[model samples]
Target: MHDDHDHHHHDHHGHDHHHDNRYSDMQARVRALETVLSEKGLIDPGAIDAIVEAYETKIGPRNGAHVVAKAWTDPDFADWLKRDATAAIASLGYTGRQGEHMRALFNTPETHNLVVCTLCSCYPWSVLGLPPVWYKAPAYRSRAVIDPRGVLAEFGVTLPEEKKIRVWDSTAELRYLVIPERPEGTEGLAEEELAGLVSRDAMIGSAIAGAAS
Candidate 1:
C-alpha cells in the first residue's frame, strides 16, 4: 500500500468558490422542491412565513425577559427561583415543555456557578432559546468537568482553588443553568431597567453581571 498526500492547494479561493456554488445550487433545489410539493397539494408554502413570524414576533427572549423582571421586583420570588426554578419560573407565568424540570444555580461574589453538560446538550431552553454555539462545542464538554477554571479563564472568569467547584451532572429528566449574581450598581433600578442587564450567558453560568458590554 502506498499513501501520498499533497501539502496544500494553491488557490484557497477555489475551495471558497466551490462552496458558494454548492450553496447556490442547494437554494435553487430547495425552491424548486417547494414549488413541486405545493403544486401536488403536499405542502402549504405560506406556512413557512407564518412559522417565521411566530418565532420572530411571538416567541423567544420573552421568557427570559419576564424572569429577569420578576427577580428585580420581588425578593421572595427571587428566593423561590433559587430554590426551585421549575415552579418559580412557572409562577412568573413562563411555563413550557423546555423548562419543566429546570433547576437554577446561584452565582455569588464568593462562589461562582458555571454550567456545562459534559455528556449532552441539556439546557434550560424555556427561558433561553437556541443555546449559544459554544454551548454545544467539543472543548466545553471535555474540559468543563475536569478543568473548569481553565475554561472559565477564556471567558475572563477565574476562581481560587480554595473555592469549591460544584459540578451538577444533568439528565434529560432535569435541565439547569446558573442565575448570575446581580451587579452592585443595579441597586435602585426598576424591574424593566434590570431586565436589560440579563444575558443568556449570565443565566448559563459562564459569566456574571458587573457592567453591561
Candidate 2:
C-alpha cells in the first residue's frame, strides 16, 4: 500500500532575499516586544523560552518518536498510518490544532522524503511541537523545493547519487511527517527503545533516522 507523492523537483533558481528579510524582521519585532514586556514585568521571557524549549526538544518530538517507533514494530499500525494518518495518529492521542490533518511519508532505500511549507510555516505542532526556525526561514522553504539534494546536504544527509528525493508541500489544512526507514541492527529493539532513535530533524526529513544515536 502507498500514497500519491510528488517525484519531480522544481527547477526554480535563486533565493528570495526579500522574503527572508521580511521573516527576519518579524522575528526581530517579536523579540523586541518580548523585551518590552519583560522590562515592564508583564511577561517572563525565561519562562516563555523554557516552554518553547520543551516543545522544541522534549515533549512534542517525543510524541512523534513514539508514533514512529510503533510503526516500526507493528505492521498493522504502519498500514493504518499509510491509509489514514490523521485517524491513526489521533488514535494514539496526539490530536491538537495544526495536527488534525496528517500524512505519513515512508522513506525507502531508493527514495527519501522532505517536507516544507513554501508559503508559510505550516507545521504539525501537536506532534512536532514548535517548528524549527530554519523550517520557517525563506531560504529553506524555497530551496527545499528547488534544490532538495543541496538542502539535504546542508543538513548532513547525503544520500547516494542514485537515490531519489521527493519533496512534500505542507499546507494549513494538511501537514506531513516523514517515517524514516528503520536502521540496521535494530531488529530486536522494543517500541520504546526504537523511539530513542527518532529525532525532530529526522521526522522533518532533514536528517536520517537513527543518525542521532
Residue pairs clashing in model 2 are none
- In terms of lDDT, the poorest run of 10 residues in model 1 is 1-10
TM-score for each prediction?
0.70, 0.74
Best by TM-score: 2
On residues 111-165, what C-alpha lDDT tens digit does candidate 1 reach at each position?
7777787778876666777677898998887788888888777877666777765
Candidate 1 residues lying further than 4 Å off, grouped into runs, are 1-62
TM-score of 1: 0.70
lDDT per residue for candidate 2 within 1-213, as digits (tens), equals: 112232344347744343322335666677689779889999975777776676656668889999999999999999999999999999998885543589999999999999999989998887888888999999999999999999999988899999999999998889999999999999999999999999999999999989952
Looking at model 1, residue 9 earns an lDDT score of 49
* Candidate lDDT (C-alpha), each: 0.69, 0.87
